[model samples]
Target chain A: MTDLLPPIQTTARDDAVLKALAGFVRQEALGPGEKLPTERILAERLKVSRNTVREALTRWEGLGLVERRQGSGTYLKAAVSPDMLHMPLTLAGGNDFAGLMATLEIRRALEAEAAALCAIRAGKAELAEIERKLDLMEEAFQTRDGMSSEEDWEFHQAVFRASGNPLFEQIIAAMYEMFHRFWEHPLGVRDFGHASFPYHRTIFNCIAAHDPEGARAEALKLIATVEDDLKRGAANLKLSDRR
Target chain B: MTDLLPPIQTTARDDAVLKALAGFVRQEALGPGEKLPTERILAERLKVSRNTVREALTRWEGLGLVERRQGSGTYLKAAVSPDMLHMPLTLAGGNDFAGLMATLEIRRALEAEAAALCAIRAGKAELAEIERKLDLMEEAFQTRDGMSSEEDWEFHQAVFRASGNPLFEQIIAAMYEMFHRFWEHPLGVRDFGHASFPYHRTIFNCIAAHDPEGARAEALKLIATVEDDLKRGAANLKLSDRR
Candidate 1:
């Protein structure tokens, strides 16, 4: 387990402290629900201040890796297992183009599968919710309300919810901001009106018809359309840069 | 943004404080690198103790959402954009069977796509690494070293690396622990010898041949084989429970 975490950079004392505490947890082979040594003990062991230990513990708690019981002490809420994966693309810093493309690729895979699952498993209420969102998109298109993007997002989220896999919903939800940003201000594509409404409606129709394969195809097509737009936009940017 | 974050269950004062800080950041539309108000000011504004504010900031820092600078103050390191997605499944708690199934389904989608991408993008060196892992798997089988599983994992990881998408690698890497556990002591499945060697070889061959669709098909077939075993194992468990 210790081998999983790379060496901690000693740039910040707090970061080093956090890494040390994580190392301790990994070294001890502590699993979820395990108790940790007291802060004083940890501070003494790591040769760090108690305040540093406290801060690190607090941070771990926030990350959902540990839990603190007021009187009992802090317990390992989740094990930082050696095999656990880390988030590769972070939205924190300015978005990297490669990261953005990688993210879109992932989204395509997930959303495509989600559409298939929604076709097979979506309940009546869920289907209705999706339809309602579609109606809102159409209404926005007709009224020029410029709210189709919001409705479109809701429609996709409805598909995720209908997939009945909380993990899918959660993963997509986690990328919701990135996806939302991409769709609204899509790099090269300017028009956000009813351009993609037909594709979305075809997706809806496929799901409504209980055609998993068809829904998957439609979803992929929809994603392809966006990807094309992004490529075109990127090319335009390049051309402009050259000019 | 409030609509995006579910109500924070007020189980602990610190949790409440954390939620409030998150809310403040959202309401104020804090972006990445934005400076947060001083701890003293935050405590006064949120009506929480300074200790509580410190604890919450520490937690946020741990979560990679904020950064604390010794002399300046704490600043938002990342935007808590309302559109941001949240991780749906956590490996911290005991692994629930449903979560496991959901995770496998996700792995299937990701790995299948990764194989396709690898077929299209992998360079000669990347292909050689994958081939090396396969050779190691075969050697383990012949030697009866029982290290086939590790080599098998390496093979899949190599595919992810070949995909040229760091995000795919990261997501799979995150799920490594779960996948490792699933393969090792799968509910009822045993015999981790060269049983799936043919399927893996076919996947490798497809990639080497630069056949994206074929590689995808082979990857899905490989995943389906495992899924079948898992399903059968799950059924066996259910029957045993009934007995």
Candidate 2:
């Protein structure tokens, strides 16, 4: 069995560089879009190697915290504390059974909001993308069960994008990525979310019809089906353990 | 003016290490709590120095993606795609005016959900913590304005913790960190959420009363007040530009 590990550690070198960068930005009172000092200058001042600075900046770029211009210097994309840039969104429960339930609860809220927003805001391009993803999901599920299907994931992602809120898309995409990474093996579920599969079309139709309340109701129903599947999967796991 | 930078770059070395770690985890089919190869082993196998592997692991630890025991090897804390491990929750709009508005919109949904859940799930300890934070916020605001007050921030964070969902706390904390970093200077706001201040006590009362619907409604009201502040802030910025 894995040992119970304490959740504390000395700061990593790259992390120290990030912390130094935050200090520098705050000391200089740099606002969004303001150019940061060059990598060489930052490294010299912060007493870290240029590669460390570059790597930290690159990671910040990925997080939408900074922008590195080709000819110009790197600029602050967002005004965030050092701590905010380091850790991605995740549950303390990790990938345990409890974590999955917590994720479902969070998704229940987010998906409902996304569907409602999509219904009111999705444009022609977003609608087309959603429909295309739904078609892909349907075709994929026709050949096989919907367990861990990439198309099913893509359909949900498209719906989030249709919500016209990039934060929802980012947050949900991360959660789904984490969920898909573990859902099949540990749960021993072969055909999860199949019950919720038909709701995709109804949700799409509601959005297409510009009915926010209808879309939200359908999304919640879809989540409820997934929750039921999750409970049943857990029960089956328990039964198999006894056997 | 800051240069318009393209959001594309070659992967950094540490990022390469993280990607390789993900590949390693997948190839080995490491599940949650499964032991990872030692840093020395991973460095040798992945053709990197031990320092790089250690740094990557430390970052993963911060993201709650891995846990490092003292004597035992590092264990996978969560089954997450590598992409999810790297970027914290953030808006694509960054820290600009648009980003603030987008953040407020996301918070509207999250805060209401959090408040409702806090009412249903918060334990006595959590409730006490919430009360403590609210008292601190009240005390801090009595001495001065509430703009960018740490106490005010802590109060909201405590409420999020009471929601019993770590993801909500994580996501909202990141948003507020990013928001607080820029809200004062660019917007020229000396005070914020003052209009929403009294609502905190009311919301706390609802949570204390175990009133989920009331908590949710008051949370929405708090966000609505902030939204009005944002609109007024923008209009004031325009007026100042003319000056």
Candidate 3:
């Protein structure tokens, strides 16, 4: 109980129910789009309330793995999963580093394309928003704001939105959500601390100029700095302590 | 609901709950590892029964987006957030074509890495199993087994597993999962009446020989074959449809 979660008192039943279903997925060799049994049956077998089982099912449904029709049963959605939910499953099964690094590469592909698309599709309003977000970062630098990091994330998020591909925005945003911890480090803290807003300005300029190459170069520059900072941290850390 | 999924019913409540949750993710500004309210509270907020909420929550928990503690409460997992549950969310909000292509390119990069890793790390047992699976496909050519298509997937899945990178495996697996639907065209289908197991054997050889370039090239060959088949299908009507 305490070992599995935060030692909460109320939701153990739900957790147990989900555990049962996941166990079923494992043991029964169910693939996506495969439907599970009725709550009455699952509850009777798992020794939980139908309410508990239903709650567990709802959570999974929310995650987009389970698709339900009003009169139809729940079926696994093989294609509808988000990356935010997948990384941890990989981590749990063993392969966190591979997942993270691969994700960074995925980011490079996505953001590079996102910047290009933003340059092409961003309207005056979206571009203005991007510029405004960049300005916010500048203000953060000037005032030494604690939330500068967030400002940075927001600015890029602004770009993803401007790219006009909801899927791009969502996927990149989801990756950021899952990997925020990896991206946030002692070096990142320092980089964000004294980091000039000029790099962001470069991105803004390239985007505003509608220069795809320039935008990509600027994006790469930003990633380069972050990578360099991360590398430096790795160099400075003790062998056993580094992630 | 019947129109959406006519094949099942028990899963509908759970599916609606997930849809509601996906709507929540699409609508809310929740961050990873952020806890929602207790089951009773969340159920009331979502207008679903506590059981429904619990079901969705359980799914999320299994997906690794939320961690459930018996006595404390369920906490959002920072690493495996809700965003990663589906296809690239980043692609959703953007302009068409360009952004979509960019997302696919990012996928290509992931696939390349996964293929390379699979070449390097696949075990004798795993390698042998992949060969066995491929052999099954060869036999399927003779008997016209229903398992041929599925065996194809297992072969790729084995490659991912052998990569020893959970993230790579899962992401690559998901990408493959997404691409699988385009298979049933008249020109393709591994129907044996059209192609043979040798196509997969090329990939197997490269991987077993630990030649990353070879594995990649072989994979490209397979993909190209499928692509050509799809192209051909477009030029001529699907045989099944014609019938």
Per-prediction TM-score of chain B? 0.61, 0.68, 0.54
TM-score of each: 0.66, 0.68, 0.49
Please tell me the TM-score of chain B in candidate 2 relative to the true structure's chain B: 0.68
- Top-TM-score candidate index: 2
Clash numbers, per candidate: 7, 0, 66
Per-residue alpha-carbon lDDT of model 3 for B4-31, expressed as tens digits? 2112135456556655555554355456
lDDT of candidate 2 over B1-243, digit per residue (tens): 122211222456566777767766666667998887788877766667777676676657656677887677888877755434333664433545676777787788888889999999988999999999998889877866564357877888999888887778877776766667655454765565678899999999999999998998999899898898888788767755421
The residue-level lDDT of candidate 3 at B189 comes to: 32
Error of 2 at B132 (Å): 2.1
- In candidate 2 the C-alpha lDDT for residue B62 amounts to 56
Model 1 chain B: ten consecutive residues of lowest lDDT? B85-94
For B1-243, candidate 1 gives per-residue lDDT tens digits of 233333344557676766666667778788878887888876766666788778877756655567878689888866664323333234422254565777888888898889999999999999999999988877876676444777788888889988987667767776777767666566666654334667888999999999999998998888877777767777767755421
Q: Considering DockQ, which of the candidate structures 2 and 3 is the better prediction for this target?
A: 2
Write out the backbone clash pairs for model 1: A85-B173, A85-B174, A173-B85, A174-B85, A174-B86, A175-B85, A177-B83
Lowest lDDT block of 10, candidate 3 chain B: B88-97
Q: After aligning candidate 1 to the native by TM-score, how far in Å is the CA of B90 from where it should be?
A: 3.5
In terms of lDDT, the poorest run of 10 residues in model 2 chain A is A82-91
